[model samples]
Target: MNGPALSIQTLDKVYANGLKALDQVTLEVRRGEIFALLGPNGAGKTTLIGAVCGIVQPSGGRIEVFGHDNIREYRKARSHIGLVPQELTTGMFETVWNTVSFSRGLFGKPANPLYIEQLLKNLALWEKKDTQLRMLSGGMKRRVLIAKALSHEPDLLFLDEPTAGVDVELRKSMWAQVRRLREMGVTVILTTHYIEEAEEMADRIGVINKGRLIVTEDKKTLMHKLGRKELLLDLYKPLEALPPSLAGLGLRIAEGGMRLVFTYDPAQENNGVVSLLDRLREEGVKCKDFNTRESSLEDIFVQLVGDS
Candidate 1:
């Protein structure tokens, strides 16, 4: 309760096909914070989660959940965690209420109909509690998976692409639900294809690629360090090439030469932006308008994963 919600040390996992899915991947999820794990396809995001949940055995490593050794004390470590997997695993014939109620029972938790009722209400599933899983929409089914995951009331929760098929509205609703969970002191580790989701909610971010943990840092710090900002100048007249005076300012002609794009790192001491503006004035280049844009988490993710 006082230490990390989950701690993984030198984690290594190699499949029987001789594919090494994880390479000395080490990470820790802080208590009561939302940590986002970002990666591309076949990047072992799920494999790492599987290893922690005891669904896949690691070739070598040690894991601890709330300071309890994962391997040496698997049950104790597992009981404090909950997983909402990528795929929907709830039974088609089971009613929503029964499915969630049964999940809580699996953890040896006593039946609490009042708590279950509140959970369903919070998720907007109260009306459909008696409906079978097969009758629900894709988004509704996904919500059921979340309901099942939360049924046990674990301190740490892993949501793997939790809103993949959901619409924008429903996705926002789930995001609100996740915030509520964090407010209740649940430490969440989320893997998502939607980089904006991480941008919107994650307190910290971790990037994994090619079976290796590439970087981990506070969300804002990561963005400030790796994210670049661009200043786009809308020229009054089209130019075939950049002015000679602005050659080294990282300026490029775009929009059929109607615009000048100056890419710079705002975090750097000399971002070349000020010099570029001064040179434009000295070189008789006139711009009707100019605007700056900071790279989003998606841009940084693409660059990081691409380079990794």
Candidate 2:
């Protein structure tokens, strides 16, 4: 409440076989914001989450939740944190209501059936409250997991690959629910393989690769700085090869030579759009139509990780 929702300092991890899982990683989650952690597989996303939730021991460094040191004050720190893991490890025969209620009890909270009911409803799981975990479909079970995590009413929630195997509709539903959670003053930190998820939902984004945090910035800043934009020129006639005059420009033939694509950084003062058009006209290249598109988060992710 006084400081960041979660603060991680100089975190490090190494395994028995001498595998370095994390390398002096440090990060902080701003209060009441949706912070998305993006990384390729085995890039320490899960390990970072595990360390903060007291599942995996950090080889070095400190972690605090709402100003409480996680190691020295485990209970107090953990009480403010909730984790929805990627795996479905719920009891197979347990009813949804019972499972969620049991989770609240594990946190030593008083039984609040009204809260549980509303939680179920918020997750669209109220109708399935009486159904056992094994009897529900995959998406419904995922919802149950989220309900269980929020049963304790934590100030901070960590969602690891929340929509990995979910359908498109369910994924959208889950994202909407997360946004509502943020509106309720809950800090949500999520790891996702879907680049669009971070682009759409996150206020800030942190990129990790090879056990280190490569970069962290506001989503808009990352897009404007590192993201590229493309100019797609539709040619009136197909060309067998790039024209000699336009060869110096970073233009590529696409759509079976009927289109010329020029990619440039939007942050730069000169994007070369005018120069490209002038050069094309001078070279007797005719353009039928044209459109432009900004580079997506996926493109930024690939470029960042590739460079690192």
Candidate 3:
């Protein structure tokens, strides 16, 4: 509701090959909130993150991190944000402790071994701290990346595909750590392919497609705005086709006429379900059972991208 911790105003990016990567994208990430950017591959998510983190330069527009312009005040703005890249590009021979420590030093921060210790411990990387990067498992390496990102104590952190290719247990642990980070007052902006992760962790959701930001709103608001639930009626007997009298009701027959699926907006003032059932009885249609199912974020994402 207030001024966001990070702001992207009319952001645009174009590659040398004349491909547009971002198109006047405008977004705001609130302080102390977990914001998830959801999109398909090549949706410019990584490019947007790279622009804000000073990795890939934007062709146009402004990025402000907590009142500091990312371009003009590069050092100060960068010091306030940390990025955990999708790739695990840690130094193969460097110990986890050394690598995390080195990342902190890169930010021109004074040595704070205690902070590094706590970060590693919090990420469940303390036991692996002494192990070389190449010697650790893929999951451990991912945690080390997170620890390194938090090494400098940034106010904002970017996690790009943090749970990609990880096991269920590791993913759960990572989600728990993300919640802890938000509780610790770190504003987290993550780009993820896993809609479940966004649905589970994010306070707000932003959808991007074809280098354009389609929507950004509260997670619940987005879900409510686009989510749909269907009432399915299992017919006791199979019918050759839907009766002509029920044709105007917008119901589709399924399972070779043994089932009928009716899609209706639950938010509407009147669902008209009872009337439809009454009409069905008039048509001699009897249902053995009925149930409802809700749509998920994945459904919303596909619809949004398709429309965009």
Candidate 4:
């Protein structure tokens, strides 16, 4: 709590098969902030999370949780953290109440039925306390996982693809639960395929690509810096190809040449919009109408990872 919720300095992980999962990755998660780690599959998102959670050992560098070195003080560091893995690993025959209660005890916590009861209720699992995990639906089982994670009342929580493979309604419900957890002062770190999840929830986002952390910044800043805006012009007549004069102007023919799409950075002093319009006019290109659109997180992710 003195420095940050979690800190990793020059972290590196190399598997026995000579696969470099993480490459000198350094990151900091501020206290009480929702930090989203965005990356493509096999980009080491889960490997990084696994390292910090002590499930995977680092090959190099240090990881500190709340100012305590993770390796030197594993118990203390682990006690303050909770994890909801992407996998469903609960025992099929175990009742919801016993599963969560047992998880708390695994952390060496005393039996506090009141706390456990409230946690189960908060997750909407109160009515299903006596039900076996095998009988619960996918969504309800995910809720049980959440309750188990929070059984010890950790200060930091890690959710690995928390909403993967869930229905739209269930995903929305999970998002609400995450928001509630953040409101309760739990610093949350999540890895999600849904860029919208990060866009909607993360205060800050870190992008990892091919085992490297390519970018780390506040969500708004990341968007403002890398987000592209587009102006689409509807052509009066379709052209086979772009005019020669309009070359190197950052323009593209779309909709089978019935439209011209111009992408530019909004922060630039000259976004080339006027220049493009003037060039279009000089080229005798006729436009019936036009509209503008902003880039989404998915756009930025594709661009960044594509570049990598």
In order, candidate lDDTs are 0.88, 0.91, 0.90, 0.91
lDDT sort, best first: 4, 2, 3, 1
Supply the TM-score for candidate 3.
0.83
lDDT of 2 by residue, 79-183 (tens): 999899988897999999999999999999999999999889888899989998999988888888888899999989999999887889988988998998898
Worst 10 residues of 1 by lDDT: 241-250
Candidate number with the higher TM-score (3 or 4): 4
When sorted by TM-score, best at the front, the candidate numbers are 4, 3, 2, 1
Candidate 1 lDDT, 1-308, residue by residue in tens: 48999999999999999999999999998999999988887889999999999999999989999999988999998898899999877689999999999999999999999999988987789999999999998778888888898898888999998777788998898899899889878899998767788878899988899889999889998877767888999999999987677787668899999999988888789878778878888988899998999887677788888887
Model 2 alpha-carbon drift over 4 Å, by segment: 230-263, 266-296
Candidate 4 lDDT score relative to the true structure: 0.91
Candidate 1 lDDT at 214 equals: 96
**Model 3 spans with C-alpha error above 4 angstroms:** 231-262, 266-272, 275-296
lDDT of 3 at 280: 92
> Model 4, range 1-308, lDDT digits (tens) per residue?
27899999999999999999999999999999999998888999899999998999999999999988899999999988999997888799999999999999999999999999999888889999999999999889998998999999999999999988888998889899989889888999999877888888899999998789999999999877777899999999998887789988888989998998998998888889988888889999989999999987577689888897
